[model samples]
Target: MTTLPVRPVTDVPARPQPAAPRREHRLRSLDGLRLVAALMVAVYHYAGRGGEVARAWGTSPAEQFPTLHSYAAYGCLGVQVFFVISGFVICMSGWGRSLTSFFASRASRLLPAYWAAVVLVTAVFALPVVAYEAVSPSDALLNLTMLQMPLGVDRVLGVCWTLWAEVRFYALFALCVVLPGVNRRRVILFCAGWTLAAALTRSVHEPLLDLVLMPEYAPFFIGGVGLHLLHRDRRDGYGWGIVAVSFLIGQHYAVRDLWNAADPHAFAHRTSGGIVLVVAFAFVAVGAIALGLLNGVNWRWLTTAGALTYPFYLVHEHLGWPAIQLLHRTWGLPSYATLPLTVAAMLILARLVHGWVEKPLTPRLRGVLNKAR
Candidate 1:
């Protein structure tokens, strides 16, 4: 807020200056990284689901091409990256805000885009899959709340599973906001508890805890929060330690995944350490972000890419899988080419939703919500 070079000279008093606009912190590199993460997941779903379908129908070959096999196997790791990012972003968002403000921010950012994505996905997937599976309108509508899993109902779209983890993370973090004396130190302790639970999550059979803790992925969420704290106070080694513990635990999961993978060809390349590479990349990326090495990633293009991420993730597989089957059957296109083409189509659809649906509706929705208060 720079003062005026010269104040107006008058017999009467001058009016007060208006407050400066608040500076919103935007991470550009993370945005770019988001697109990368989304692409990784897309590759995983495209090739991986194809393999699953083939195996289910007993049409899949024992061997696959080098690139597709590796990507299909390891691509699932991208969701862990999303989790880390979600923790960091959620923590960053809660700073210096009241609980109400925090919830409003989260809701405004999520619900509109999510609702639109739900409709888009349902239109693409549910109506088509009814031929094979029993999908009632009640079960499909349950996904609108994003609590289908917790309610013991199946998800309308497969991708909705990860969102259930995110919703639980949000709810847990909200406790920190509303409770007294739950500052950074307590948050760090909470991360430790979550990490420990990852090791011995006895509540797996417990319905609510199963949805809330999601023990296998809790480490990623806790690690992201740890990174947020690390970024907040660089001198805090405790934050670093928590992040390290989470990474080690995540590495363990990756190793387990590699060994248990039904398809041996995903590890054929052998350079990336197979599924371990995604977690490794996440470890490095989050650390780099926390250390502020990626301050330069604040480009507008990166911001745009980041903006495209959520909608793209929500709708990609919903659109891609059916399109993949359709193209293979009707046009006789190869799976590899069909995958990229369908991915491209999904990207276009994402851009449409972002531009025409989300961007236009979000502000109006927020304005309405604000005014109603």
Candidate 2:
């Protein structure tokens, strides 16, 4: 056997090419988890809006099953979860796009669906049901901009308040995109400075300022941006300090709000301290995003649930209230029965809006805007 130069099996370890970085694949679970957050909000609304039947269902629904009530009451905080997710998604989405493209994308997503929902709500107002709220002509005009809050007008739909926050956040983030040297750090600085401004104006309530920065809610958004940085950079320690500070600030305000409002029905922290619920909610969102818990959770219905959330959220409150009132009052259905019926109706209507209105309108709007540009 010609002893070929015995190449040692462990020949000089070839310089390990730096391990190819792990690509951050799309987290489908986040999409699925969105329905989780939306469902929580729905449950919150169902219970909170039960009105007289709330007592019939049980004791103070917030106090009856304290655990269930607490979770449901805190469900309004689901919007915070939505906010953080929005910040992360927006950062990911608007990263390299030009300002016009980013704004066009937002308008295409937001405006048409909102206008359709407004029309649907206006039609519902035409019904004889006038117990919940009177139809205001001004609200109809103000709501068209989705800037009602900042402009000192009531939202046409109660839930559209969240849209106002989202619109301002889009404006804020768009400004960041245009600023040179804007990075996660710049965002944190803006958050801190913004929070400080809110603190300075704590005694004075300025709708425009609050609507613009809403620094009281900054932590949630800041924490969200932090999560995005962690995901994109694949680093744990990146921008965590601001996230921690932001979360703590959020908890402080959450507790204070419950204390000040002291609506026994809405007090989520009555059984559990507000801070604990806040922390748990934060963890649910952070854990979901960080661990990719919902990644590749590819069920068609799950996607449908996620898609339904927007229209359902928009249409559910004003519309479902009427459905629940009709069933509970006319049919004499109990709270337990009407609750499901109302939610079911919302789902059906949301499906119609998503299929006929949003899904169709979005492409046309995008095409029109793109062509105009």
Give lDDT for model 1: 0.72
Compared with the true structure, what per-residue lDDT tens digits does model 2 show for residues 175-284?
A: 86533434556666666676677666666787667657787676677777777776665455646665676677777776665543446544443433754575457645
The best candidate in terms of TM-score:
1
Residue-level lDDT of model 1, residues 1-373, one tens digit each, is 8977675577558689855533347878888878888998887666654544443223442243445665565677889899988888887777655566666767777877788877766665546442234346788788788778767886666788888778788888887543443367678777877777656665446755655677777878888888888888878889989888888887776566455545554433323366566787897897798789988767688877888888899888656656766666567786667667888888888888899877887777766665554
Supply the TM-score for candidate 2: 0.81
Superposed Cα deviation of residue 295, candidate 2 (Å): 2.5
Model 1 segments more than 4 A misplaced: 1-24, 50-67, 125-134, 178-182, 197-200, 203-208, 261-273, 367-373
List TM-score per model, in order.
0.81, 0.81
List candidate 2 segments past 4 Å from native. Answer: 1-26, 49-71, 129-134, 178-208, 260-275, 371-373
**lDDT, candidate 1, at 148:** 82
